[model samples]
Target: MVLVTGGTGFLGSTLIKILVDQGTAVRAIKREHAVIPDALVSSSLVQWVDADITDYFALSAIFTDVTQVYHCAAKISYQPADHAAMLHVNIEGTKHMVNLCLEHAARLVHVSSIASLGVSKNGELITEDSKWDDGADNSKYAVSKYESEMEVWRAIMEGLDAVIVNPSVIMGVGSGSKGSGVIFNMVQKGLQIYPPGTVGIVDVEDVAQLMVMLMNKPEISGERYILNSENMSNKELLDRISKLLGKPSPTIEAKPFMLGIAWRAAKLVSLIKRERPSLTREAALAAASKLAYSNKKIVDATGYLFKPVDRTLEETSRLF
Candidate 1:
């Protein structure tokens, strides 16, 4: 049986649907108040378990008879106010899961983000071997993910069979206004400002498929693969979404000065509404930076080709 954490999330839910369809017995762990996605609601092959990853006793019990474990639960935030929660969930929670997996001796597949990977300083492509520089201007989200991956690496040293996949921005349908889907929604609403940063993007299905493939290949243990399909500027990506959605493409380029003002205004609005700011200072900086990742490692390792991100965007636009 396969145990998947964060099974109610965008990627995790999609993965459970695929596994159940393939007649794989899956034990999915979700928060008690988390609503099950419509796609997995009727699947009898999925055994739902309600428990937080931080609860070692609860999680340890669920690991019984599990052959493979997929650690997908994570906290994503760029707000400074959320850093504590991010560390608790993304770092400490992962440590608990790592310990449990070690005790059960189950093969583990950790779903990490490209945020954990280091940036290229010499204008070169970032690959699996890039060293994460802690002194760099990394976001709290990136720091949390990097620390979580450290737990996975620590487990590997202690005799855990595990592999990690660092996926770029995941794009697909069914995520609604969450995750990378918010980018599509913003474009459809006639967002006029475009960030100049270049980002690596991959389809949600491709990420899930690669995780399953890696889990089946024990020979690939103790290695992490970057799962990006293509690298494109934010303007190009938004324009493609705009065309597919029949919306006007962004006309204004967001310079650093403009983004600085925008984030401050967003912070004031968030304070008034007592809600999280739509644009944090860290997120604003990331939007204006150019970063690209390489998928050569994963492509060469598994011989699996990723679907073109532009096609994925076009297909996802139809669903909206």
Candidate 2:
């Protein structure tokens, strides 16, 4: 059986469904009463367990009959309490998973973020080799993911058969969460105008298929793959979404001065509310950075090509 941590989560749910449809025995970890994604309803034999990732002892019992594991759970949002919680789940919790995998001798596919991949200089394109290692760098979310990946790499070095997959803002085929959720809210409010920046996009369906393909391949045992479809500017992304939703695209461009005001106002409101601000300075900078990556390695290794960004974004917009 395959054990999926955070299986009820955005990407995890879609992935689990694909596995079940293929007649694979699947087990999932569900945390809350949030509506389960449409993907999970297909397989009646699939098991759903209530467990937090940080509990290693409980996980040890759970992993007894599991042969492969998909570690998709993570604490990624920018909240005040996220920092401490992230360290336990994303870092220490992953270390625990690594130990469990080693003990059980199971194949582990770890899900990470593009945030863990270090930024490029002068708007250059990045490859899988460009990973973030040092501390005192990137956002809290980035640090947590980086540390977790470090644990996986460490396990690999210590004779664990683990493969890593880092995704750039996963879109498409998910039920209003992760990057899809953020974009959903933005488009619903007629957020057509965008900041001056670019990002790599990936449809979650394509990514989930790639993960399954990777599982059957033994050559990429210790490799890390970056899953991205196409590099798109903010304007391109907004334009496509607008077209998909039949909304009026923004005519008033977002000037730097206007963004500065909005970010500052959001920061002030967050401080008074005593919470981690949504539109923080770092997040805005991350969004506005010209971050694009090459997926040639992933594509070549798995022989799975991703669909175009426009099609993926349009499909995602049509859902919610």
Best by lDDT: 1
- Give a tens-digit lDDT track for model 1, residues 1-320: 89999999999998998888889999999999999998898888999999988887888889889989999999898888989999999998899988988998899999988999968888789998999998999999999999999999999999999999999999887778888888887887789999878899999999999999999998989999999999999999988999899999999999999999999999999999999998999999889878899888898989998999878998799877
Instruction: Report the number of the highest-TM-score candidate.
Output: 1
Q: Name the 10 consecutive residues with the lowest summed lDDT in model 1.
A: 172-181
Tens digits of per-residue lDDT for model 2, 1-320: 89998887778888888898788988888775645666566568578887777888878888978889999988876654567887787998799889999999999999988888988866678888885656434778888888899999999999999899999988886656455667766766888578887888888888788888888777779988999999888787777777777777766666667777777888899889987676866666666677889899987776786988777776777677
Candidate 1 error regions (>4 Å): none
lDDT for model 2, please. Answer: 0.81
- Model 1 error, position 148 (Å): 0.4
Model 1 superposed RMSD (Cα): 1.0
Return the TM-score for each candidate structure.
0.98, 0.93
Question: Candidate 2: where are CA atoms >4 Å away?
Answer: 32-35, 131-137, 252-258, 273-278
